[model samples]
Target chain A: SVAEQLTPVLRESKFKESGRITPEEFVAAGDHLIFISPTWQWMTGDEAKIKSYLPRDKQFLVTKNVPCLRRCKQMEFTGVEKIVEDVEGEDGWVTHETDDMNLNECAEEMTLDSSKMDDIEPKNEDEDDDDQEALDMEEFDVDNVDPSVAIIKPTPIATTKDSETDSVIHTRTYDLHIVYNKYYQTPHLFLIGYDENRQVLNIDQMYEDVSQDNAKKTVTYEAHPHLGPSMLAVHPCKHSDLMKKFLQIAEEGGNELSVYSYLIIFLKFVQSVIPTVNYDFSQTIKTT
Target chain B: MSEKKVFQYVQFKSLVHHDFWHKLSDIKLDIEKLNESDKTIFGTFTNLNAKNCLLELDCTSFNSNFKTAKNNFYCKGTLKNLNTIESFKNFNRNELLKKEGENLLRIIENGSACKNPSELISFIVLTYADLKKYNFHYSFAFTASIEPLIYEVSPSQNITDEFSENDIENFSSSYHLLDQQQAAFFIATKHLDIILLQNALDVNQRDMNLKDHNLDSTYFCFSDPSEFPYAAWILRNFILLLVKLCPILHGKSIKILSVRRDEKSSLLLSKLFFIQLPNKIDLDPINMKWTGWERNDQGKLLPKLANMSNSMDPIKIAEHFS
Candidate 1:
């Protein structure tokens, strides 16, 4: 039933984007149901709007108008109080007697004013007074409570720093992009690193991460039309062999690494080369 | 330095599903039945166990024109020292096979079996023949483990005065010869792509005549008249060879013409090299018929042609050049 009421609002593009339903929107639907109910004459305009939102199949019996009020009073009070208590407990706002006191006070107010409310205008004013009283009570409670007592305690901060930095070996994270060079008919790895500031890392920064032998043997300074002039690419002649070795290492490590997502596995293998740098795809960068 | 003798053993791991030991016993029973009914097929079985079994075929005793006549094959092995099925659950079948193979190689190299042995342990060669044909042809499958005698060549014993870097590159590139034994292991384990590359290199050396080629391009067509089960091997090998030897052909645009293509073979080709099937063209080369088609920028092969003819027509191959 709640889903049925919310579906139209949820389908709205703006609501979908924001991923929320405002209280006013929820109340508006409730108002529509109240306006269509059989007890419209007994309700004020505001009450009618609220009651009209209730389902048409259920008959709304005004509590005082019921013939057997004496029998239903105890049952009604217990059920309503239980629901309110459960909701208050979940919200962590269970003041010792606030909800029970409010319910009794509202009931006393309703009984004292029942004989005075014959016309719609007076009934509307009485409903406004009740709402104002509830709002005032909430404000009074907030003002009276101590700030320290009212505030929820924050979670304890994690004591552990990046364990990698303290270890003998230092590690870094890099972004690996494996582009299929149609001309070479081979996969080419485009590696970039992140600085401490998380910007596109310089070639000089990456040089420190790689071994001196591998830096000389495999790394080549090449102008990538998209990545720019400083981009370092793995030498094409050794690309296939290097890939085979990377795959072999991955296989030995117990990763199935399918032919389709070999690029992800390639990035994983390159993690060993950089050791410290986390290797991830470019798409992940855009999302984060 | 002295020449050192190395001893190695090829270990087979048990198949987790479908009892391998039971299957071998069944085969042993079939061999006995064949020996009773057929005079041509003679087999001897020994050391049969849950972990080990030996099957020896005496083809020399039978009179035949088959190549098996010259080769007396011995396949005596056991599937022991294996990881349990629980451990296997974490690994892909290919990865497990490869790990097992490497482990077996390690055991052969340094295990107690190699220390102070009575006699030298040599590598065994296995030959499988298709007996359905009148004259059966045998294919050699090599195991990964090998026992080779190492020779000592001192640095001071330099035969050549000097050699260029290009000379060294060429020497090293051709030196290892792509270890057919390792290639065979890959094939037996269904490592299709590696086998494709190795077989392609082998086919390229045997089929292509590089002597007359000052030309920009050349085509090598392989055809076998017999119902070869591994006919697709040629096409796979050729495709890989093109990528390895002449990557520039990717830009030049190579086309594969096939008369009939099946989904499984097409999917395999697509997975190995992300090439999709192309639109059909009306150009029909003389003596060659095109059925199913897939064209790519790298290169293509007419898989159906391998099955259609005993040898590819040179004139038809020239049509691509034109």
Candidate 2:
């Protein structure tokens, strides 16, 4: 136990700063820093700024949900091929199995809230084709929205009796994110499961394959490992080893001096749920 | 060094709760019945101040983990002098095996012995308030007794063989006291005055239905006189004397300091947890430097350094307090 407590001191031999460091700050500071942010919101403006600010010599490690940083190039590791296909045979997700039904309905609710926007369209007469594509991406077509969007919906808490205290306790669910590493290949998406007390129950690899719709060119359905072959699949890239190592080091339980572990867990959970397209982090680095 | 006084000890004082108004009325009636010759002996009335006295309360919580054998009173010589595994194995292994093995086996089978799961956890609450002309100083301490139920499919028949009423009474009182001593050390070290101890068993019963208050109860001691010589007298007398000799140190304090084994002291953090009382009493309040003291081989402050010192009178150490 004492040896375990000394890990923060061991990790500090390589760094100048001491005490606790946040997940975002850690990713920005260290070389070979891995980013496992699953929330697409991280892909927008803030991440772009961080990408620009990162040192050129430093390697940017990404697991999932990476937006195209125009500056950095992806580093696709040799060996495995990246494929997007719908994995077959499982009844992906049922409405009953949905953790939160309200979250599942959020896209419809958002579209209803923005129905007024439809009336004010075409204000820019000189809009280019690229501008149209961007606007289309932002629009919420509830019917066409991915079923996986339901995963983010907030659920009402439920209470259960604790045999220990003989008291009814409302169990809280924790969001876990992980990046699975397999050495030379890209890191795979990992999901964490916890029992009632928030102790980690399981860690599993999540892979997603993609398939096309009637349009042929527009890839629609992706096969997720957990949900099987479905319209929404989570893809695992080959170069996710770096991200996995980062998570492993964080979870090894030495210095709880950072909240980066919690952040990484949350990120990987999101990645396992949502598939990002041909976004190879290693390739992004080489191009940069 | 100040001379330590051999103070007289008194015990079993009655904490009288009297209705003064009723007493005054009775005295007036007595005065009217007095004869003319007895007129000189007149009843008098005066306002009296209530005295705030030292109070001690004792409580016990049950931890199943601390359970010993039913008939075993004294610990084995081997268990008592245990240091290493080799020494432990050489001791009476049979006794240890019977108790430890049975407990472990019970857990494997699930706690079928007790119907109520709530009996596994319990709490004892005690409150002590000092009466004073001004604000009274209140202190509280709590000890938790954890008793894990050992479950076994085939439990010993001796367990189910209910003890006779007298045997139950004897074991409950004496055995409970023996069990409570470990918790008492924790409480004393914490310097907590008012304690609430809870056990896994919910023993709440209707007061009206109860006959003897002591039955099915842990001991409760309030306004205990015995503690004066043991605890309160030493603290009060030493503090008062220390203040009298050094008037400027009146605002200084002596607090209970708790140090865990592996705690580290740092510039940004202090390893001590200090709970300040109503006021602080400074004794040797000024930390002065001493020239003589020997460090042990382990670099620890030697316990007998002052006794082994060569100096006739040690100088005041560095005044870190003042």
Candidate 3:
């Protein structure tokens, strides 16, 4: 299974380590394969080498900051560009944003309700050694428990100049937005789930509102503040299935699957959920 | 946003060589000391733009003239005693000659190897001519120091000719010259832009590299690799700015990893690779080589991390998009 997950990355690279395979063995391993870098240093490479191997439409979910050269004609690859160097604290911020629901509800629904949906659980968490050990040793049941409720803190809400409701939490049909201070030290995602009366609902209450005895699914994402919220939304018509799977995973505390490495994870997740989400280079301008 | 500074210098040698004594005018300078601000650190009154450039002048008179020449042309009273800038610095005579000598050798090596090296010969010749003017005062000068052949710009006397076998023979017979080397760190009043690199992906060709990744954000610095200690300081400030701006990106969600590559071998050392992945607590783990985490002598985690030392729970953090 690890090998399967690693196939994609390996397919995109020509291994140079002694124990690693030669180019021929890699070719035989073949296309559209999944791969995982054992550590972040693997991403560091000369520009020509990285350009030659990385796929045009594939995913590159780097969890670390390492220099890489992309877009080399000598490498026989195209559409490779160093979009950005993600220096964790120096460059930018990627904050997780939650809805009214909590982690327990998410985990329970993901595992217990998997029979109802045909989506694959996010594999990122599976690579975590500690999580694998935890899953192996502990069996948590989410049916009887309720997530915790906290004291409601009121804060000013930012809105457009034309809008009238200034400090109130607006109840929309689809999503909930929580106000986080700019100086907040943690990137934790927070959301205030509310009822029709604009009252905040705690975790157990949110679970009951969804009211599916069987597993329900949903897709959750951390808001990449720089990209705006539109990138967080599921494709049109593709939300139903994704929502079902996402909800199930979240109900079971499946936070691991939803955490992302780079923007590519979201793109891959998007393409996987909605096949119509184009990964075509024809639509992408060659900036390099 | 602090006030920026610009560096400007006047070449006294230029004015003296150009026969522009009458044209010389007073210049004022508002030069300040490094730390002390209250007392007038250094000021000048008289200008020497018209005076026959005195090769040697007392520190006080030179300081006064410096102030008159240019309000900003004053040094820290260090260079007033000597006509040449090299006289101000307390460098060992041998060391100065050695460094400058090495510089001359580097020039020769570069000139011999590079194409269109006419400028190299011109620079050397100009420097030699300047030193020749002071030859009478320094009797210890060696015969090898200023060989006639070294000064010979043959035929039309232009020093721009490509090196021939005969030129090599002439150079072997030519003597060497001594000059002081330049300083290591030269801080001028030039404005510089610093770009912060985040992911280290191929960015040389991208207009939207850092700016695209994070909406157009203003960065305080982009350090040059040549500036070592200063570069490190700049990097530290850049990190401090990010922490002040967005502290959430400090911990577990993102990790900062660095590896030093051997310039000659290209070998990557594993232990040299430092990674600061977010632990349970949101703060980044400090794993600097000499100093590990900021902890007490008890070998315990620092006070800030004591509560969350074992908090790195294996909570599923990423989603698998099928």
lDDT ranking of the models: 1, 2, 3
Model 1 lDDT, residue A20, Cα? 28
TM-score order, best first, reads 2, 1, 3
- Against the true structure, what is each candidate's TM-score? 0.18, 0.19, 0.17
Each prediction's DockQ against the real complex: 0.00, 0.01, 0.00
Candidate 3 C-alpha lDDT tens digits along A44-149: 1112112233332111211211111110111111122221222233321122222213322332333333332222111121122342232210111111121110
Label model 3 with its docking quality class: incorrect
Query: Over the stretch B1-322, how does candidate 2's per-residue lDDT look in tens digits?
Result: 1332222212111111111112212333464322211111111100011011111110000111222211111111100212222332233322332333333224212432122221211111111111111111111111110111011112112211323445434432432343322222111111112222222111232122112222212121111112121221112212222232233323322332111110111111101212112234322312211111111112221111001011111221111111
Off by over 4 Å in 2: A1-101, A104-156, A160-169, A172-184, A189-192, A200-288, B1-277, B281-322
For candidate 2, the TM-score is 0.19
- Pick the winner on TM-score between candidates 1 and 3: 1
